[model samples]
Target: MPNLRCCSSSSLSLPAESYIYQLCAAGPASLAAISSDNSLRRFDRSSLALLPDGLVKETHAAGVSSLCAAGDGLLATCGKDGTVKLWDARRAGAVAVFQADKGMPLLSLACNASSHSIVAGTELVKPDAFVLFWDTRSPGKTCRQYVESHNDDVTEIQFHPSRPSVLLSGSTDGLVNIYDTTVPEEEDALVQVVKHSSIHHAGFMQDKAVYALSHDEMFSIHPVTSADEDDSHADEVKAVEFGDVRPVLKAEYVVQVLVDAAGSYVASGRTSDRSLSLTPLVHTPEFHFEQSNSWMLPGAHGEEVVRSVLFDSESRTVYTCGEDGHVRLWKEEPASSAELSSIRPTKQRKEKGYKPY
Candidate 1:
């Protein structure tokens, strides 16, 4: 057990058994633990007991910044060392490592729904934020890099649940861009860049400036992979957004929803109390994370905020990580449709002369 530094009412000191900053739930009873020492360990979710993975020391240079597990024994990790590495978790060895260009730190990573491809977002100190796409079939090889859209640091990247080629990314510049991998040269064809009014035109509102706003909104959608369109040559592919939209205090909390395998429910984490929020998989432009009502979890690293969140589709569990070095899991009782209906405030009821008959 490692000592964790926490503040006490009387004083600040390191305590025994400090929590790690990273966590991934491989199954209902299992989780992968990434310690500050750059070692990877698997633990039992119920008991938090370490499993016998034997300290995988592959990421020696940089602490693991991000991790994703592909359905079939595949695990991918990104490091501050400006590198992305793929590993065979079942074999416990490094499969391949890919390096990024100079001056960009690998900020976020995601594996396609098929788990055949991987994509990463990088921080841009010089020109603009960019994303790198990798064909994981060939590990340790070069990946296709794209930098055509973002003007700021790329903060979040998520692959569409059903469309392996479709990807969505959010950035500090307050822009969301969707990409299609099927396009030979994606820079040419794709959805128009979506910009939020509150974020892109934030300067116009002086009174609500302190309210955090949607400048750091993270996005998740239930993507439609393929459907016959009116044009015989083209297939209809789109993403449906649901749930509440939130104004996150930190830029990383912009988008956190995870679509269920059945395409029914979308699960997301709220920073306020670290509560798990669930929403339907319908087109809900009104579903925003209302800052005033949401719960925020305690900061993991001193005052450092949450950097990433993941979900287990099978168990319907949410795991979150932050700078505080604590990985917390949130589980809520499934809500019935009747319960959800009651929670929604009625517009007619809000009217001045509405009377309950």
Candidate 2:
């Protein structure tokens, strides 16, 4: 069975009465987080120690909502103050800022590594919601604005890891839309749509599949097939719901869904319970729930809701941040040879109070 152990742990204190909302692995040994106190802080990945002179305090006038690690030592963040800021991780201030019209609240953010474009989603307004795009090289100017995609608040947005022109956005209206950003017009950019009850987060898995987490604690995976040359089969190109929807963490909500760097496992952070649960993706045909090789890291946040979990597969380490304004580190432990050899075979038997049906 898979073994996940908490080998060592450390915590870092942020500004007074701060609440962390998002966390991202900035580098192999470093992490970055955004908080309700309108601050962005960085820490050592292994020790969870606050890096001296590694803070950008009050960069946003309001609470920060989301964070992402852009390429080349850059960090991207969006805030309720209706702006997206790009910061150099080695420095203490923002290098560029992207603003929205009328100072609309920016709730979600994503950065495209291939095209060097930044996308920001807005909170719900009376008539419609919008997704703003900007070129990273030429900041402070709007490249395009998509206003007809979602009807409610835009909750999450992500760019395809391998495809530079593809983008994904999810909203509280229970719709997940995929768009081809290369198209010049907003009306012609939409490629597909996947509907659910209410979406909390959505992201691509290895470029072919997309996974979505709902507010009701359910998860679903969809498969995207290649388009057919024949026009008669064009409708068949829509994403097909591929697998059973299952409860991920059995909590009120799942803050985030994270896949390991090697794509070997998937994990989720649970609210109210303060735990991180992991499940191996590669399983045998005879796999049973009792032998599924899954484990939980309990007492993860100590009565606080864990907002984010980041994994480093190279070193087999995990980092988590929470509402308590603390970042914690967990390392895997290998089982001993003696402990494995001591196991004895068990005899199969029926339950004590049951009979054959």
TM-score each candidate.
0.62, 0.83
Which residues of candidate 2, in runs, are more than 4 Å off? 1-3, 7-11, 225-252, 264-274, 281-291, 334-357
Q: Which regions in candidate 1 have their CA more than 4 angstroms from the true location?
A: 1-22, 27-29, 33-37, 57-60, 113-115, 197-255, 261-324, 328-357
In model 2, state the lDDT of residue 53: 74
Cα RMSD of all models vs. native, in order, equals: 11.5, 8.6
Question: Model 2's lDDT to the true fold?
Answer: 0.68
Question: Which candidate ranks first by TM-score, i.e. highest?
Answer: 2
Q: Least lDDT summed over 10 consecutive residues: which range in candidate 1?
A: 201-210
lDDT of 1 by residue, 1-357 (tens): 011121211101112333244456565467675655566666556444555663476573756666767556556678777778766656757777777777357767787646478788777757767788777677644467777777776756766544566666756676666666676675754553555422211110011001112333424332222222322212221332321244333322333333333222222333344334344333233233333322232332333344345555454344655444555555432341222222221210022111100
| Winning model by lDDT | 2
lDDT of 2 by residue, 298-340 (tens): 7777666666777765665677766677777775546532221
Model 1 lDDT on a 0 to 1 scale: 0.48
